[model samples]
Target chain A: MIILGVDPGLTRCGVGVVEAGASRRLSFIHVDVVRSDPHESQDLRLLKIYRGLCTKLDEFIPDAVSIERVFAQANRNTVLGTAQAAGVAMLAAAQRGIPVALHTPTEAKLAITGNGQAQKIQVERMVTRILNLNTMPTPADAADALALAICHALRPSGALQGGEREQHLTQAQRQWAEATRKANRGGNMLHRGM
Target chain B: MIILGVDPGLTRCGVGVVEAGASRRLSFIHVDVVRSDPHESQDLRLLKIYRGLCTKLDEFIPDAVSIERVFAQANRNTVLGTAQAAGVAMLAAAQRGIPVALHTPTEAKLAITGNGQAQKIQVERMVTRILNLNTMPTPADAADALALAICHALRPSGALQGGEREQHLTQAQRQWAEATRKANRGGNMLHRGM
Candidate 1:
């Protein structure tokens, strides 16, 4: 299975693609940060982001899309732009009949570094180690996107053979997966079951 | 010239179209509220709103599109959904090569009721009066949409002949128009100069 992850923002939308094997091994396929001019009008900036995501969607054709889910209490200044970017990302995925899942920032961090409150460097280090890459992805947003994809792939419910993966999963991983599953069941995650 | 106004929201997206003559006479063309099921996923809801706006854009081929400009300090619970819906609305307009403008609630209310803090009923009444409609438009969102279109049409820069319209413009109208013009110039209104 292939998954596309997005760390959505108007100024810099980070996207990464990862391929997952039946054995649960993951391989990085692509990564990039789509950017729009800050001086441009909001509509045009949104258009650029939407078109860029559409192009990536068409190119990768990932089975699922994972995006960072922000809450209402997020930063007052940048939350609006972040939500708008995530909106377009979800729309882009849904337009092509791809299911989209929103994972909270904490969820991605916990999945990567075994600590929900992990620092940026720790998360990046873990993502690099998990993906088995020699060099870390440049910019924090790109690394964050890869972490989202990995989180989605390793989630308990998202695993191909749930029973086998459950036995090998760590205590932190199990707890995170269970929490995510409950969130999805409670309709808080905003997953599109396409 | 025709203008399509949108009061964007996820559950109920209000849309109105109006024709503006060179003499500044406004005529109502069409009005409807595009709705999406609340039980649907966010992606599907956004997709529905985008497709609905695109249909209106293609049907009317409006010269310009006007949307309610919401601020960051708005209601926290609904602000995210509103911004997302507005994002898709702007995208729909931009995708069709139509210029888009964002007018604040104060601007629309002041243009129609001569008061920025006008009540909903008062704004609705004034919209009916301005459009010369026999029956008031149903739903507050629909009325707000028409008011936005009228606001955009009467703005100082949007008028066909600024000098001619200036003679009959009220002090409130002139002030509102001036504010909008300045906001556009300041890069605060997010007007797409298509």
Candidate 2:
């Protein structure tokens, strides 16, 4: 299956698309950073990122998308930015009907280096070794994205199975659904004018 | 100044835009929830959110945006979704040349109710009392958004100052600036052939 991987950020997102099959072979489809102008409004910048991401999604047409799960304790702004990036990546995958999977950084490291605490360099080395690349992945973000994808590839399918995690209902959606269900159940009563 | 507040989430985001003056009087400009369809791809849902936010930014023309910060936790998927929503909000503000601010949930509660440990309902009541809304804000998300705005208003000027608390680069602009500075310094050093 074609797997798309993403390392999300507000201004810069690293994306990598790889083709994988029975032989454990990987062919790089794409890798790049999506950015926005600093002087622009936050809304416009967000739009730019969205558009850029959509373009990437369209181009890759991957069977699955994998993203790194951020688990960091930092400043409020930093955390906010990271969240936004992750949201965009998730949204992109959801829009295209592609199955999406998430990998923790630690899991990715462990999968690659047999150590959850492996450093960036170690992970990079393992990625290069596993993928058999002549040169290391340019930009750490791209490497991280690849690692996330690799982690997903190694995960149990059931572990990545999808359905609504929480009940799939907005407050309004829930209210409407409940009302409709009630109406359906009470149809005989309504017909009898009771 | 006009301040937009956002309570980011994976499924639904509560957004509030309010104008606050030096006298602390507040005017509600708009309030709503940005939602995504679960049946759709996550990426597309995020794009919808990004576009919706952009439209709001255009309509309100806020001077700054305030968003809730996500904390590091074991819930990897939740954290990822929250981060993406936060990123969309930040990009929206930044693109508009509006500065963005972030506050922890406790900081916002403390600012609104003088009690960091205040419950959600308690914070909502305080927000209603503080803003003198005609009625309690419809959904808790909207109330939380207003609370974030209030927190930003209560903060001292430049209270949400931009700087890397741990390193030196938090936002893209800051990172670019740092890179430029280093480049210029390196150029000067190169002129001396060192």
Candidate 3:
């Protein structure tokens, strides 16, 4: 199964796509950064990010997407931007019907470096070792994203299977039923008033 | 200036547009809900949100966009969905070059009801009174979004003035300059190797 991992940020988003084979071996397929145009308005910057994300999705076409979940942080602005990036990643995956799984930073770090509070350099070193890369991944963000993908690959529940999609469809159906009921009730009321 | 408020969610997004006059009097221009088909993929849901937002923008042509900043809560899944909704809203505003501002729930509640912990009913009542509505806003989410827009308007910082585009441009220029410098340095290294 091919899994795409994303480290989301407003200015720069790091994406790493990995293909997992038998015996949990993960192979790197692609890695890159999606950047927002700094010269554009904040709205335009977001658009740039969205477009960049779409391009990445089209290029990688991973079976599943794994992204870092927003952690509780003191900087509200930073958190808001991070959340926006994560949202874009999630939406991109969801739009394609690719199941998305969220991994916390600690979970990824622990899975990669065997330590929850591992430093960036340590995580990078372990990521290189695990993925058997020729050189250290440029930009710490990319390395972090790769680590997230590897972490998901190591998890028992990480692989994209058919059962998960079925569950999602079932849940969506229930929600649709509820919304339809509400809409019918509103329509009935309007007709009665008329 | 006209400020558009958005309360984003997975199923329904509440939108309200209010025109802020010089005397601080507010006029409601539009209020409605943007919804998505439950059976759609996550990407389609985001697209639905984007299209809906664009329609709203085209219809109202507001000067600024104000939205609730997603707060980290107990349910990671719910927070993720809220963040995605927030992203769609921000992206929609960014695409239009409209300045966007984010307000916390407590901040919005305090601005509308004079208390941070005010109940939803109290907030709805205050919103109705403040906007002189014919009736209380349906679906408290819409009322909350309106309250957020009002809070942003009344803020001393003048939240509606656009900022992201200019900063992005400056940053992009700086990055370009840095890249040029790096290329020059790399040329020197190549000359030494030759």
Candidate 4:
């Protein structure tokens, strides 16, 4: 299955597309940042995001769209913009009838690196290695988007490993397991507006 | 000029349409609420908001949309949803090429009842009287939406009264005046992402 991962933002949003390859391996298809001009009207800024996401949705036609959940404790100033950007992403995917998944940043980190508190550099490094890319996904935002896609792909519904591994989980893995469970359940969770 | 006032939310969004008459009088055209199912998926819930706003935009075709500027101090649990709802409203207006205005709840109250700290009941009373309605607008959300429209009607861009009132503004009024000035100055202010 193909996945589109979005790191939603107002000034610069990250978008990454990945497709599952043979033996459950993942390959990167596209990655980039969608930037909205701050000089433009707020409405126009939102339109830029909405249109950009729609274009990507039409082009990729991903089986599922994954995004980082907007946490309440994020930078207070940017949280709203981030939420709005996520709204555009969700709207685009929903309009096209695509499934959407939201992963908390930590859940995404754990899925990719088996650690919830992994730093940006560590996550970026792992994303490059997992996708078998020669270089890192630039600007960090794009890499974060890729991480979200990876998180979704590793969910129980996306791969058998995730389902079987749930049975042998450690006590500390319980939280991560619950997180993936909510995501794999696919839209059963409440709308946290991300 | 016609104005569409939006009190944005995830569960229940209030929308009101009003037009300006001679001597700066305001008359109500319509008022209603758009509600989303909490049991629905996040994407579907957001789609409900997007579609509802699009329908209202098509039906009203207002010259401008007036929405309450989302405040950070709102209920933590729902702030993200409120912001997303606002994003949808902005997208619909911008896509239709209509100008969008964001007013603080205080700004709306100040416009209607001449006090920024006025209570909800006071604002509702003023809206009913100003719109020449025999009965109060059902649901405080609908009343608040009308109050937003009334606020836009009395703004500097919406009416001459707003321009002249700037001369006698209070200290608190000065800040709001500057805020609107920034919004009208076309994205001159820092992007707050709301």
- Each candidate's fnat, listed in order, reads 0.59, 0.46, 0.41, 0.57
On residues A34-147, what C-alpha lDDT tens digit does candidate 2 reach at each position?
887755544465667777878988987888888765443433344545555676667667767787765556667766676767899999998788777888897998888877
Q: Which residue pairs in candidate 4 collide?
A: none
**DockQ leader:** 4
Q: Which number leads on TM-score?
A: 1
lDDT of 1 at B96: 85
Task: Give one digit per residue, the lDDT tens place, for model 2 in B112-185.
Answer: 77666778899988888878788889788888888888878765332224344424323432433333344334
Q: Identify the superior model by TM-score, candidate 2 or candidate 4.
A: 4
- Residue A176 shift from truth in candidate 3, angstroms: 35
Clashes of 4: 0
Report the lDDT tens digits of candidate 1 across residue range A142-189.
998999999888765643235677777787787677656555665644
Off by over 4 Å in 3: A21-25, A36-45, A73-77, A110-119, A158-194, B1-3, B8-12, B19-27, B33-55, B58-61, B69-84, B103-123, B129-132, B149-194
For model 4, the stretches where C-alpha displacement exceeds 4 angstroms are A157-165, A168-175, A179-194, B158-165, B168-194
Residue B116 deviation, candidate 2, in Å? 4.4
Candidate 2 regions exceeding 4 Å error are A8-14, A20-25, A29-64, A70-84, A92-99, A103-132, A138-141, A147-194, B36-48, B73-80, B114-122, B158-194
Query: Clashes in each model (backbone N, CA, C under 3 Å)?
Result: 0, 31, 12, 0
Residues A1-194 of candidate 4 have per-residue lDDT tens digits of 99999999999999999998676699999998999997687789999988988988899999999988885547776777888899889999999999988888878888777888899899999999999999999988999999999888875442334666567665435557766666546443323322
lDDT of 3 by residue, B83-106 (tens): 667778878787677888766666
lDDT of each: 0.84, 0.67, 0.69, 0.82
Candidate 3's TM-score reads: 0.64
For the predicted complex of model 3, DockQ is 0.18
